[model samples]
Target: MENNRYNNFWRRLAPSVGLFFLAPLVGEYLLGNISIKDIWALPFLAPMYGGGALLIREVTRRAGRGWPTLILLGIAYGLLEAGLIDQSLFNPSFEDHVLQDVAYIPALGVSAYNALAFIVGHAVWSIGTPIAIIETLVPARRTTPWLGKVGLLVTAVMYIAGSVFVFRDLQREEQFLASTPQLIVVSTMAVALIGISFAVGRKPQPKIDRQTPNPWIVGTLSFVISSLFFGATENWVGVAFKLLLLALMTAVIIRWSRCQGWGIPHRLALAGGALMTYAWGGFVLTILLGRSETIHLVGNAIFAFGAIVLLIIAARKTHDM
Candidate 1:
């Protein structure tokens, strides 16, 4: 009985563990923001990215919520990371990026373009994509809560600790803190989003009679759309275009998801497409950052290859389901 119980515990915790590491791997390293030489930072990043992802997933699943709720929570996570932890959204000179130079909104003390990019990037890629991929890999436990009460407490504590560590480190290094009003606005927005997620989740999903598109087509479209979304220039026109694309993608996905034909394959394809985008896009980003070193390129190749393999395995698993 003791052995059996131990096995069950690990079985239940496996997905959580996957998300714990996969979140940071996809969010930072796979995106080429952190080079291979800095792989040591993964442990530091895992607490915030992985812990947040686990917390978001556990809360959404335990509440019997779905993707909409998860995505909303992801946006809230993005807001917290940008506005509070790292203050990148408000820090004009963050890592010498000079983010606020373009599409700067004086009243808000933020760059409108960067705000959209960071928030949406985190929502869709950092949190949402990793959750989708892991859940796809373990379909049996997809909607079930993976962590127990103790686990939840630990995750929360880790997230808080990680966030505070990053916040303090960045504050000391940059000597920057967002204004009180800016902090207040960000906090308010995050709270509102969290509230809205639960409210939206409570509503019954509407069924549509229309036939869903083929999974291959869906995957292709997702790849193209996500590619375009991330490739947008850092300007007002790019911001407007991204917003339009987001609205259209949201509408289409919602409509198709409501249809009876939508299933695990479609979901997997959507995630796979987006995953592929980052796989190749990482190379481009490395080049753009003028870090086209052999090590960086080699790292990008390894990560991109791993992504493709993972997607293939996921596709096969999804088909078996």
Candidate 2:
């Protein structure tokens, strides 16, 4: 009984784990050097902290339909950073486009990057969240469903579209002046479409047990401690942040899996965590490699291959269950 309670405690603590850890990490990364909008983005991804929590909370309950919010947050951030803000910060240019004149009121001083951030965020979101919602709507049964696959495809398309916009806009500022609306309009349309669906078929929200110890309590404390370790000033001192994050994430994944005992969703989370770790680790390795001239392609291949093999094994087990 004690073990069950201990297990339940861990189960409850899962969602807030990322938020609590990610905020200070962002602050340390920024060191208070950037604009308020940039600084705002430093923690909890600015304008989207609530959205991030909503995603995490939803995922932990009701088979995780809340992933869409995460995507939306990502899209919102991207639109702000890449589309709107970068107009000046990364690639400065003045466009006399009529729409932008309206977009940037003389008083607001809002950059093109700010206006376009939602596009990137919306695209990233469509990939992860929409599929999650549909799956929650009708989980995988015998029949292969179209909605899940379509959502995933849309994610890829949005990412590509965002990338194209970035590259083209960076090359010619006027192209961006004309293209900005295309990005915002599409993103707004998608949100409006999804909002209608979300409004009606309510996603289930698990109640917090009154007797249960709050998961956020311990999770938040651990996250603060983790951030301090990773948020060190010296680059060398913080080389281990990804490693630490992965270790904690792995522990969380393992505990959640064991607590739930190898069901479909638990196994899926394990796979997702492993993928997250592998992706982060791969990023670290690439940074260490340091240049395209002397890129460590062979080492990357080995890591990728090994991760894929592990993923396949775990997936097989998941299927068997």
Candidate 3:
């Protein structure tokens, strides 16, 4: 009985553990925002990125919600990270990057291009994509809650503590804080998005008579579109184009997902495609940032290879399912 109980506990904990590590790995490391040299900081990053992902997943699943709800919450998490925790949304010089120089919005005190990139990037890559991949790996528990009440509470506390730690550390280093009006606006927008998520999730998906596309096609399109999204220049034209692309992509996905043929393989393919974009995009970013150090290049290659291996595993698991 004790052995059975132990096995069950580990089984239940496995998905959460997968997500806890995968979130930061995909979000930070694979994206080349932090290279091998900075790997030491992962322990610090895991709580905020991984813990937040776990909490968001648990809450959505517990509420009998789905991807729509989780994606919105991911955006909310992005807002809190940029606008509140790191204040990167308002910081003109964050990490020596002139974030506000391009497409600056004076009224909002943020770069329009960056605002879209950071928020949407966090939503899709940092949160939604990792959850999708992990759930695909554990198809049996894809829609089920993985955590008990105590686990949920612990995740929440860890996320909060991580956020506080980042916030204070950045505050001291940057010595910058967003204005009251900016803070209020960001807070309100985040809350509104969260509320809208539940409302939108409650609405049933529209039935589609059309057949879903082949998984390969779906994956290719996802890869191309996501690459375009990240590869766009930091200008008003790029921003406008990305917004249009975002709307179209959202509409198309919503329609495709409603088809009866849409299943685990298709979902996994979509995620895998996006994941690959970051895998390669990391190299481009490194070159652009002029960090052409051999170590950084090698690190990007290693991370990209790891992403490929993970996708292969996910594909095999999906096939078995």
Q: Each model's TM-score?
A: 0.97, 0.30, 0.97
lDDT for each candidate structure: 0.91, 0.37, 0.91
Error of 3 at 118 (Å): 0.5
Candidate 3 RMSD computed on C-alpha atoms after optimal superposition onto the true structure: 1.2
Candidate 3 residues lying further than 4 Å off, grouped into runs, are 1-4
lDDT of 3 by residue, 90-196 (tens): 99999888899889988899999999998888889999889989998899999998888999999999999999999999988999999999999999999999898
How far out, in Å, is residue 68 in model 1?
0.7
lDDT of 1 by residue, 1-321 (tens): 999999998888889999999999998888888888899988998999999999999999999999999999999999999998899999999987789988999999999999998898888888999999999999998899999899999999999999998898888899999999999999999999999999895876888888899999989989999999989988999989999989988998998899879988898888888888999889998998899579999999888888888888888888788
Sorted on lDDT, highest at the top, how do the candidates line up? 1, 3, 2
RMSD of each: 1.2, 18.1, 1.2
Regions of model 1 farther than 4 Å from truth:
1-5
The count of residue-pair clashes in candidate 1 stands at 0
Worst 10 residues of 3 by lDDT: 199-208
57-145: candidate 2 lDDT, tens digit per residue: 34323333333343444444444444443343222244332223323433334433323322432332222322222232223321132
Q: Lowest summed-lDDT stretch of 10 residues in model 1?
A: 201-210
TM-score preference between candidates 1 and 2, better one: 1
Residue-level lDDT for 297 in candidate 2 = 44
